[model samples]
Target: MPYEGPRVYRRDELTYNRYLKVEELLQLQQPQSDPAHHDEMLFIIIHQAYELWFKQIIHEMESCIRAMMAHKALPAYRRLTRIIKIMQLLVNQIHILETMAPIDFLQFREKLNPASGFQSIQFREVEFLAGLGNEKLMGVFLNWPEYRDTLQRRLDGPTLRSAYYDLMRAYKYRIPEKISREPDEKEREQILDALRELYQHPNHKLPVYFLSEALIEFDEYLVLWRQHHVLVVERVIGGRKGTGGSSGVKYLESTTSKRCFPLLWEARTYLTKEPQWEAEENEVSDL
Candidate 1:
């Protein structure tokens, strides 16, 4: 199985830092201002690096979701696990961003003008792939063509939502035999169900309890991610409005309430031993 070419493997190429050209990657930091603004350079670099990491995360998530729908389960599972762990690395970045005091950020705040983390298109794409699917948010990237193309492609792709609904329809649900290019009531419901189930990561009384539980772990990590962001902003800049015109802390708090996987969360209220309480309350008191 080994047809090794002359360059089959250069030993140094296998080293930890070999693949990365530090000169090029590290040279991307151009702060757009004077030496009087050294901290701005640090701020700019950290955020730039964060965006790079976000790009990788988005790529992996898209692949994982695609793999799952294609019935290539193992690769998808591995990719998703990697994405969740990358989130931990993402949290560590806040501590780095937090080092810039509010005063430091203010020195170049004018330079930022209308730019804000709220406008990060890659971050938004991550949200969309995680099953949030709010394509209308494409409006946010209207000013940037590169970003618009990337996000619009994700929204318009033969999405996992469509692939999943096909699975459901085959099982006797009154759903479509395939995912449609246009939105449908049934397709939307199926997407919700798939997200909820995947995100909830429940402990079903089933043969493979571990798999069921890992799903819940995935869901929890995703939410933990949102919560972690809220806290990071709170710690870094208290109550200040974002440069992007968003009400900083308040906006992020509101976002944490929106589940990336709605069904996974809602199912708990309806699936657990306590689901009966939900029904009794909904019973005739549909009031």
Candidate 2:
């Protein structure tokens, strides 16, 4: 071991450049122009960064799904916290794209025809895994056989919403079997009634109640990101058609109201307890 006069390091112990492949990553942002538009680099970077974050969000969501399926609340809650944080980034990152004015976008926008953020498979996977599967949306990918096949698999699988009800069932909540596969309005009202009870008497199932609230937070942030996306698109492109052959901002506007976990939000309308707050107010008045 002491034979070497100079110190030596193995390939695994090499520098940051080798470990992270910084050079390779840097090479990925090739501008689609003979002489690139000044803002083209920003455009590519922002979307690329979003795709990278979407990949992480999908990874966390899948892990959460497994935990929920296994009737594990803590693991699922922890993963959902990570997902919420990534969604904050996803919502706020649109501001970076807004910095490039419409005129700047026009310079290289034509070069990006047939390519759109709508085609992001990772984003689609995140939505499908988190319980936003729609056959109409899936149809858009039919021209691309590989993407269509992958999306179809997501549609057939158990969603996080289903797995959530399964988790609640493990905790002895009376969730209907029919609601587990597809959420009907009747089933949703029944679940909302149950959720109101759970939220009102949280001591009965603290972990389950806490997890429900976390899922609601995730849902809220998901809607927020969609809202921000619509605003960003409207600000930059107005009513123009998308590069991907869709009615750009109009399509985005319709998606802002979509809910991943509707019952979680709807149930709050029925939680009318004011005892805790009233007690705090009384104490303040006495003081």
Candidate 3:
């Protein structure tokens, strides 16, 4: 069962070939000041690494939106699927911040020159692409022309929120009657009636399953990502104010409650008349 192999490269020469350029990545950390404090390296590297990851998340989201526009949803769904994995990676990244004690951070925190995640234009653009738009957040990048332009472009264009709604509306109708068969007023009325009853009673079926499950899957991930980010902020930074000038953990925690997909969560209440959401001890118990 044993197989012999080369365990290591024997003084391998650095070929200028087409593999990932190691030197560029290795040299990315350039501290902004001289006599750089020891903790400065740690803080800078951590933030820089995050920006790289943020860029990738943005790239994937743009692809997803584009795919949906082409009416090829599978590609868009595939892109959205990778977001959960990225969120898991991000969760693990919080541990790195945990290693930086307050004393260590204080050594170099004052030298940070007001740079903050609030100024991360790419991050805000990704948020725009995801459909949780806020005009106030857009103002953070107003000083940077390229970034502000990019954010404005995405803001004034089709977003994931509208796409999600379009998908849901398509599902709310039955094919043949609504699509292929051309439903008359009476048929449309019947479709609405059936949906109303199903919403009122659980021992019933929707006109279509594909759309409902898709919407729920999307909504669930949105909720999960928001909650995870809130927890990360709470753990790493605590109650102290954020460098971004917010009220810190409490502020971030309140944001998590602002559901990106509000209607989807509210719609669950209409799923069954006999208490779809029974309030229990500090939790919701759904039946």
Candidate 4:
């Protein structure tokens, strides 16, 4: 039997450009600057790239939340690992923008007036998904009805923090029935105690321990990104007001301290190695 050579596909068949919509994507980077300053193209492309990565991060986080809620620590950990790497990439990407000299940026900066990074709906979505939802922040999107509605849903939805606590509760940890942004001293003590136990005796619950460490690392990287962003903005624009009317670097600096999982961070101060007798006593008290 004669072997038929691989059939040649028609031009209309799915080519790489068609599959990825490369043409449409390239067309989206329209510079608002008259005469189209060369650096402006770089500026627009960098942000578009960021938005693409943000979309992927949100996808991974949502899947991780579901995995956590289902008590599937391994899958959740994998997703978190991916998210941390993506965050690292994002942090490094800032350096590329830093390469554009402030003078070069100014050539087209004024054209961006009234348009700011603060208007990014997906950025807010990422924050809301991470348990950092601030209803007040929604004011930025009030005029964009579709974006506001989308963010409102995320504000009402389960967050990574809530899912993680639910997972911990399923594992019989002493998580409060209602975890609040500002927990009372009693609830705080209970949370710290549970975390202390987990950290001190990690061998007892290896999967949960691994997931907890990853969660904290995720939190740490987020802080690193914010800190790096503040530095970049300061380097680029000094103390100038943001195009979106923000205080620029000062505003970004404040966000560097925001933590998605405060309890995990606070638990660190309470972590300590206990004497052998105390360990046995604590174990017996649990029974």
| TM-score for each predicted model, relative to the true structure | 0.71, 0.89, 0.70, 0.92
Sorting all predicted structures by TM-score, with the top scorer first, yields 4, 2, 1, 3
**Model 1, runs deviating above 4 Å:** 1-19, 160-219, 272-287
Task: For candidate 4, list the clashing residue pairs, or say none.
Answer: none
The best candidate by TM-score is 4
The worst-scoring run of ten residues by lDDT in candidate 1 lies at 202-211
For candidate 2, the per-residue lDDT at 256 reads: 84
Report lDDT (Cα) of residue 209, candidate 3.
31
TM-score of 1: 0.71
Evaluated at residue 37, the lDDT of candidate 3 is 70
For model 3, residues 1-287, the per-residue Cα lDDT tens digits are: 68787565445654543146767777887776567777677777777777787888788777766765555555666776676567567656656766667666766666774777778787677677766677777777766778777887887776665554344344442322332122366754554454444355332322223333443455565556567666766665567787778887777667666554444455445464453423322342121
**What overall lDDT goes with each candidate model?**
0.62, 0.83, 0.60, 0.87
> If candidate 3 were superposed on the true structure by all CA atoms, what would the RMSD be?
8.6
How high a TM-score does candidate 4 get? 0.92
Error of 1 at 129 (Å): 1.6
- Please estimate how well model 3 matches the true structure, expressed as its whole-model Cα lDDT: 0.60
For candidate 2, the C-alpha RMSD (Å) to the true structure equals: 5.6
Specify the poorest-scoring 10-residue window by lDDT in model 4: 278-287
lDDT of 2 by residue, 36-149 (tens): 889988988898898889888888888898999999988899999998988888889898888889988888889988789888988888888888887778777777889888
Best by lDDT: 4
Ordered from best to worst lDDT, the candidate numbers read 4, 2, 1, 3
- Please give, for residues 51-123, the per-residue lDDT of candidate 1 as tens digits: 9888898788777667656555446557767776777777666677677787777788778777788788887
